[model samples]
Target chain A: MSAWGMIKTIIFGGSTLAFFFILWFYNPFKHVEHYEVEKDVKAIIDNPWKKTESGKTIAEEGRELFVANCSSCHSLRYDGIYIMSVQTNPKWKNIEKTAGRPVYRYGKLYKDRFFVPKDVYEAFAHDDLQSLKASFGQVPPDLSTIYLARGEGYLYEFILNPQKVLPGTSMPQIFNPQFDPQAKEKVAKIVAYMKSVNTPPPQEQFKRTVMGVVVIGYFLLMGLLLWKYRQNLLKRLGYH
Target chain B: MGLISKFIDWIDERAHIREIYRTQMVEYKVPKNLTFPYVFGVLALVTFAIQIISGIVLLLYYKPSIADAFDSATYSIMGEIPFGWLFRHIHATGANFFMAIVYLHMFTGIYYNAYKKPRELVWIVGWLIYFVLILTALSGYLLPWGQLSYWGFIVTTEIPGSLAEAPIFKDFFKAVAETIVLWMKGGYVVTDVTLGRVFGSHVLIYPLILLALVGTHLYLVRAAGISNPDGIEYDKKKNPDKFVPFHPYITLKEGAYVMWYLAIFFFFVFFHISHFLPPDNFEPANPLKTPPHIAPEWYLLGYYEVFRSIPDKFWGFVAFNALLLLLLLLPFLDWSPLKSARRRPLFFILFLIFMFSSMALTILGTMPPTPQNAMLGLIFAALVFGFFLSLPIISIFEYGWYKMKTKGGQKE
Candidate 1:
């Protein structure tokens, strides 16, 4: 073979071999690293908070708890400038102090004591943002989305024993010591709340009926087109 | 056939539909030498239809308010509506595949120099379609209001700010930049108004404009006729046999390709759900937070790399936009009488270099602006623009060389 031809062979053949070798050895899909959780956690579970009337109550309770405990640092809504401030502001320590929680001002007669904002009170009981940020050391992510990103089992375990699931994390073991008596119920409520807030998007299901009809319809159309094509070719060939 | 013909005649007499059909479909002729590359235009049309149908269905369930947009997409369309997932996936995945096919179609045009002579307007309109599609995709990106879509628009909106420091008319340019930013976001920042406007543009305005552009494009195509693969001019007197009606022959050929394309498209839509639509997008948009790294959709990675490679934001933005505009001007830049790369060895090799550099730039675009990637990106960006800048010079030189050789009777 010519030198150039040999070079082309080496390039194409070697690359093909290399690609397959990489695929075999380092298959990304096969080696996907799932989020690891505690031994008891299933790591992968379907929505644990089943949609029921009781489940809705538990979720509502969890929403109250989340606002009191989590919302001071985190958020549920995706809009507003506070979110942007959290992202762009580097002086978080300073902002945490001066940028006090948005509160409703009753009047000067109230001695400027912060009234829980009407919106916050309307949504749920308000928490002191200044205190929460000091404890957490940084702004916590919007927990409203944790259910979407994580399995329910993981959330349940993480909330039950945050230190157990994730070491050196700031999430206090709210259940291990106090909520332990009703830990399962509390965990369920929180999970239900997270699930309620972050509802699993209605997913695309395989439309078997549509697929069946489409496939059959397509084949029927294609067969007719092909038959006409063959007849046209035959006519062109003088096969009247 | 008889009943259909009778029905068609009945409508034709009242609506004059038969003449339109006869001119556009039955008598529309394509080159006999057409290959798989030629089918990309038809595939683009098919995917555009898919996008429109799927998008309309999605719009039925989609609420465009900021507070509700994300939930409407995730809960209502994805979770609540029956087969909503399929429509959403088809629309989302169809956009990606449509852009892919459009690129392939554009590349085929560029490779064969289909923009030459009488076909320049067709190429220009097609390029405009492509430009509008980019806007359509980006505007639709904001509708989902997910973290990725939100942050992606944030990163994109920053493009105007890059123009703030333009050396000439720095104040005026800054004002122009601010106006563009305002126009896009509709306020100081991205909010409900932004979502409302973007949603309107994506669903209503862009599609109508795209439809109009597509109509003009098809009119031009019908007028000019499809070019041959060899880049030779059509000679009616000598090459009557080279013409074929587009109905059965081309339609059947394109139909097979459409099936293959749809098979692959549906394969991703069904089997590989997250491959086209990233899971990062599932997280609701947080105005307070940006993702660790922001990137455009995968299709825009090549230009995105060029955008990020330069340290200077203004020049980087200019270079990135120039990359696409240069492609639009390829026909004019290519001064050679010879259209096809088949006979132009040097030009063919250079085209290969340009293609590889583009791929390299795309890879680089996806990576963080690490020092090594930045260096490679700068080099590849140079190679990409260098090819466009030098094409006319090389074409003139090549043409002169060929003339000299032929005049000297070097060829048998």
Candidate 2:
């Protein structure tokens, strides 16, 4: 090889190594939280407010409290608790048409069973973003997917003091200790409920694991076959 | 001898299949001196195939509208559809790999002087394909309607808007810039209409242009024959030993390279998916809230740094585009009779400078645009431009020196 070629190789190889090293050191997405529902459930169960004197699970009590306090704005659609009325209702038939058949069926199965108040459902079904913003200063986000996006820790902090966690947030401190004495327990339970509902179903995990294994294995096998075939061909060509 | 042979014979009689195959594949001759770097072009084609297959699968589930685009792309496909996550990762990672391979292929072409003489059209067409690929990538990046998608779109589309600050024809330039940005965004701002426009262009328009350009590029390659690493033109009839048929030799080699590429590609798909997906992109588009740090994907970072390095926005935009234009005009700019840099120390040094400066600029692009970084970026950007602008002069000197050495009883 020429001196230039050697220099090129050294520079390319060194840069590639340096790039990978930087990627390892920085780890750009290191802070991204990966939620595991079972771990969260175990944590909730081990908490001091695991069960109320009424013998309710934390998640169960959280659900009741969420409906009374938070459900006026936020909807738990992942838990089959959409704020919108049932798809079968005449006023909501357009949602069925727009959302397609599967979603309509989902709405039919879940929306009818969930007991959202008439007024709240009416406001949501009418697509009343203007009034919602006027009331809360901003339209509230759906809580169903929030657990996965923000994680339990951030949610706990945000719920405990909305202004401190996210200044100018539309959400008020609903569980303020000045107004509600059981603020800490309520925040814990709400987070627990969020975890319970938003935890990915086991089938999703199984599918990802199985698919990843199969794909990687197939590629490995193919690569080995190709490597063997290449060696044979090179030998036949008198190049080995 | 059985059904397959009979079927092939039936088709051959009607379509002249044997003649086509013999001309395009069986009798096609590639230079024997070609090394592993030669595989990068074929690897690029393979990566494009991966992108097309995976992209089509993604399109089946991708929603183009703003409201549902994020949910459909993320939750509906990744969380609901079977093996959708695999295809999504494959498509995303394949794009990155595609750019990497194309860069390697282009560098290989430069090293071998593959763009000289009859192969200029091949280089030009290949560059067009590359340019359109960048467009397709930029447009597709916005389809998911993530925060990065939206904000990245804003940053890229707003590049031309820097013309508003141009020293000449301030009013007219400002109007033209505004008009161009508006047209690109499909409105005064990036909105659902912009998403629709990008979706149409990304999947349909750019791919069609790329396909045509790639076809032309391949045809040009075949017509011109492969350039050898030694940069010496050899007649196949005069030196038959230096040539080999493309069928078993080239095809099998490409297949082996592809198999290795696929292994590494799948490893990224399965394990290092986060390498392609930035964390800020996890959030859906919020026009009101801009992420603190926004950068284009790694492939475009060099140009992005060139744009950022200059103090004046108008000049930065000019320099940014001038860099790409200079690269496209490389065959014409470097007028040396000798194609390869192997024997020419000046050309070799210039190539290294170009390569190092571009790499430096790319690294600078990813860093925060502080004054010191910007200063470094400016210097590297100047080096990149300097390499191209000085190429013709250096080529003249090298040619004169080569003549002197050859005249001094040196064997050509």
Candidate 3:
């Protein structure tokens, strides 16, 4: 057999073997943490700062780190989430929603749209920001009710125990920065920022036209790259 | 007679299949003295299989729509179905296990100069498989549409999101990041739409990529054979028949290693009870709901630290990408003509520091990215980076340092 053919067969066989093994040996969904808003950060990491604003303490320091590392992902909305001692059987469906469905999310505040404040250029795709807008439609959900909406401390716990929180999280480790000593301090400060950010964002007076020029430029480049990649794919697939 | 003739013709076309199967079953050859580290690659493959089978079974009971996605995914595991939780934990834990083995295999290969000479393609193919595994792991994490998965995805994408200001990347940055994420989400803003797409990609697209890579890698290894201890030579005259059949000879050795993998998988599966993130994920992926700390998966610590370490954007990109890129370049690094780790003591020590530094950075990256934290992260990251950059230079310097010390003759 040709070398490529042999490789193809091996891969195919290996793939089949893998498929059977997972079926026999383990659960695929077990790693997926079901969604509930009770943050378990305390359990994941030892957070000296529970809910205090004390300065220079682990709590305050964690807030700084939270802002640096997390603010971008986490909204500073105090009201949107609800924090309580985690109940193992706390009604997962007890979550408040619009018409028995989970309330849809909007982009962050301080921008014209929910997604506008997001770094659109750095998102997974240009349409990603747009689809973000399209998905939620007009009024993005506000953070004013998140703590009440989800719960407090859940966010903290999620951050703290990411692996225990969710497997394959892109978030790297923080508590055991075995090489980097400053990791704990950074997390503390970031958490502090989240705590401090309570007020809802004021209405935007800025142009709704563009956040940065990334939107337009991103389209042109992606179009070209996609086209080139398609051409390459066609060649590889012998489609001409 | 015509029908019989047709059947015979069909059988003839696929005659090679029968032979190929027999060839591996009966006469496949492998090197003797292959070490435990080599088994990791196959072990990862085994775990990959386990994940796929269990994943498909879970899909039978899963509803990928945002409305019931979390619940369905949740029920599929939480022991609602017979042995359902087993499937879920196996796949999830298996992902982590797969990563561990891949890292082990890669690192061992490097330490033994496994990428040198005939095994170069093996190394390259192996790394490609690792890349596919990352993509698979990323997609699988998203399928549950849980709180951690949602926030975790955001954290994972955050750095890439901030790269929008690349000065040159422009809209392509926005378009690429936004669209793909949109695709991952099936819509945007981490909705059911996103969950569905991520599910399909996790189960199908990514797995296909992984399988392809694994196939190519295994073939490459067979074709090139395994790299041995650094000092070993391949002279046909010196040792004509130093190899053994892979089936009975090597498989028996691999048997013990496989047992260890199974034990680890079950240990986490049962005792850990699928240690998923906190319960906030039952709600749909909510953007407004931000988890206070946003750390990436553990494997990416070094790059994460590099991102935190550097306050700047472009440099952060360079440093972050460089950490992994350097691994790909191990073939070119350390040109002291001494191939083995044992031969060059200083190289070995510095490289150990580099590995530890990477591990440290990965852990550090998981924390919040505050300035104080970042500044310290940077210092520590710099120390680690120093570890990587100083290897060859230090390896060179040590040669002189050793000579100078010896010439001084201060020893008793």
lDDT of 1 by residue, A60-155 (tens): 567566655555456554211133333244653344335323221111122222222213322331234445557787546655456766657677
The numbered model that scores best in DockQ is: 2
lDDT per residue as tens, model 1, B325-393: 888888789878777665667777777778778767765666667898899999999999989998998
TM-score for chain B in model 3: 0.81
Chain A TM-score compared with the true chain A, each model in order: 0.45, 0.60, 0.28
> Over 4 Å off in model 1, which ranges?
A1-145, A150-170, A174-240, B1-8, B15-24, B167-169, B402-412
Q: List each candidate's DockQ score.
A: 0.09, 0.25, 0.02
Between candidates 2 and 3, the one scoring higher on lDDT is: 2
Per-residue alpha-carbon lDDT of candidate 2 for residues B1-412, written as tens digits (9 for 90 to 100): 6999999899999999889889878688878878778899989999988998998999999888876787677666665576677788899899888888898798778877789997998999988998999999999999888888999999998999999999989999999999989888888877778888899998989988988888899888888988888888889999988888787777877776777778778878876776686656766787887887898988898999998889999999999899889989999998887878666678778888887787778777777788999999989998989999998998888789878878899845
Estimate TM-scores for all models.
0.76, 0.85, 0.57
lDDT, residue A85, candidate 2? 28
Q: Every model's Cα RMSD, please?
A: 9.7, 5.0, 20.3
Look at candidate 3 and tell me the lDDT of residue B373.
Answer: 64
Model 3 over residues B86-151: C-alpha lDDT tens digits? 567566677777776677677667666677666667777777777777777777777677666777
